[model samples]
Target chain A: MENFEPVIVAFCCHYCAYTAADMAGTQRLTYPSNVKIIRVPCSCKVDALHLVKAFEKGADGVYVAGCLKGDCHFNNGNDRAASRVAYVKKYLEELGIESERLAMFRMSAGMGFQFAQTAKDMTEKIRELGPSPINVAKAQLKGEAA
Target chain B: MITAERKPLEEIIACVAPFRKVLLVGCNECVTVCAAGGRKEVGLLASGLHMALLQQGKSVEIREHTLERQCDPEYVEELNSLIDGADAVLSMACGCGVQTIAGRYKDKPVFPAVNTKFMGASERQGVWAERCQGCGNCLLGQTGGICPIARCAKRLMNGPCGGSTKGSCEIDPDTDCAWQLIWDRLKALGLTENYVEMIPAKDWRTSIGNGPRKIIREDLAE
Candidate 1:
């Protein structure tokens, strides 16, 4: 597992987290490239299906970044997204995948440092958890085939 | 409508463990309203099963479908072409929907993914409570639109049954006493006279006490 490089999918809300990520870019803040940002109109738009599909499609970790509390442009989209993340986390546990691999973070439109820091923290967490079980199984299957 | 909840992941995994290809069927009827077996649930369960099976080193091909109404023969017929490719069928509908698919395709192994809870009404968003028991004879008119058979724990016709305390049933404080609700409704409508009108003993034959029941209409019959 020494060479393991985790692939993290970060679902960023368009009005807040996405803009924060842009701020991180302009500020020259460097976060792990392991995290790939998928901009969504609102975190509420990120369905449970999308979270599970990320793991299904080989994401080692996934996290949703939305507006700060009460700052959602749609008024409670972040709250909805937070609950959805909690729900999907429970499902992940039921699937035998570690729930820590999924998370929800809140940030305002100007928190560029917060965005970069979150990406770094999540990457570290997933790195510590190693590759997700699905990836390990796929690798095992591939190894057997080879 | 009939309400249901999905069976545990362990139970579902065990049922489809031997199959390589599974047809995960969902219904758009009661189960959907109950948030149990709808298109959204089908996607969640399918993805869950995939990861769970994959973790055990078993990759499964799960084809997901949500029928317009699984209990109807016409809606179940839509799976006719897709059935050939699947080794087994996993229905996320109530028992009626499961049986519909099972009855239509005698050759395929059909399994239920949800436990049919009861015929109930949604109390609110994400909350459902049993409201009816399908007792052949309904006494709602006499009880001021409340059913004693289904709501009362003891099914008492004339009751507040010393078990009722502060408008809640003795069995659970959270459960509202059916008789108490009936009295309140009757009093509000100024029909308190119905409360003392001695209800006769109910005939058990009208219920499922005798056997399975069915209704036939001559005009509707071909």
Candidate 2:
């Protein structure tokens, strides 16, 4: 049987994390290509619904990388995003999905190393957790013979 | 600025136990602003119900619909098509909206997903504070805009009970002394003379006690 490659959705802030991700590319940092990046104007723009939609769309792991504390492009944007991420984490737990699947990180636009570390750490953690339990049940419900 | 919170998931599930095809209806008015029932809450409740039904091995066709204001007839009229497809409606609107939905759709069973608590405002974020008893009498002109009917531990119209100490109520230390607040505000506005005005016991007949109060605009009704 082929190994399940976990799908990861990384919401990268347009101003900082996205640029840092680009910098990681330019610096030739090697990380798993399974991480799909979505750019938003600010991390605060990512609401609880967006996180739920990501999970519904089959993301095994999700992360919101924003500016460091007090460095939000929009004042307190990262703070708002952090609170929402925490709130969504609780909802995920209530939904029987592991809260670790959702993560919030802070990084400067210059921290390509930190970005790479986050990617490696999250991939390895999700790998250890195995395929999401909800996904397993969902595949069975549809009778696709996974 | 009415404050509201969602009813527990188990309670909501129990209310819709008989329905197979359930439409989880949500209101985007007071409930929405308070984060109890809105488009976002509709999604949460719908997912919750789906999971619950799935666990019971009972398949429920779940759908979600939110109206701009469920209490108003115009927005509820927009629900005709969605309501037609569902076996029952689980309304997240307040008490008034629930009754309105039932009245509007005589044939369908409408269930309330939220227990309407009170006519109150937010004291702080996610904290709802009751401010009005709907006494039908304007007492704020005398009490410095604070309603003792709702705020006081004992609904003393004349003055504070003996439990008040250091400008806080003894019933709960966290609460501010209602009469103290009234006195301070009255003093600030140079309106202490209003406190001396001996107001009689409130006439509650004009309020909800007499049942189903109605206001008809005679000139505009035609």
On DockQ, the leading prediction is: 1
Instruction: For candidate 2, give the lDDT.
Output: 0.83
Off by over 4 Å in 2: A144-146, B51-59, B122-127, B165-167, B220-222
Per-residue lDDT for B66-130 in model 1, tens only? Answer: 99999999889999999999999999999999999999999999999999999999898778999
User: Each predicted complex: what DockQ?
Assistant: 0.87, 0.26
lDDT of 2 at B25: 85
lDDT of 2 by residue, B1-222 (tens): 555667776677677777788888888899897788889988877775665555444467878889998988878998888888888988888988888899999998988888777788877776787788777876888899888888888888988888899999988888888899999999999999989988797888887678988779999775
Model 1 chain B scores worst on lDDT over the 10 consecutive residues at: B213-222
TM-score for the first chain in candidate 1 comes to: 0.98
Count of residue pairs whose backbone atoms collide, per candidate: 0, 0
**By TM-score, how accurate is candidate 1?**
0.96
**Number of the top-ranking candidate, with TM-score as the measure:** 1
Tell me, by lDDT, which candidate is best: 1
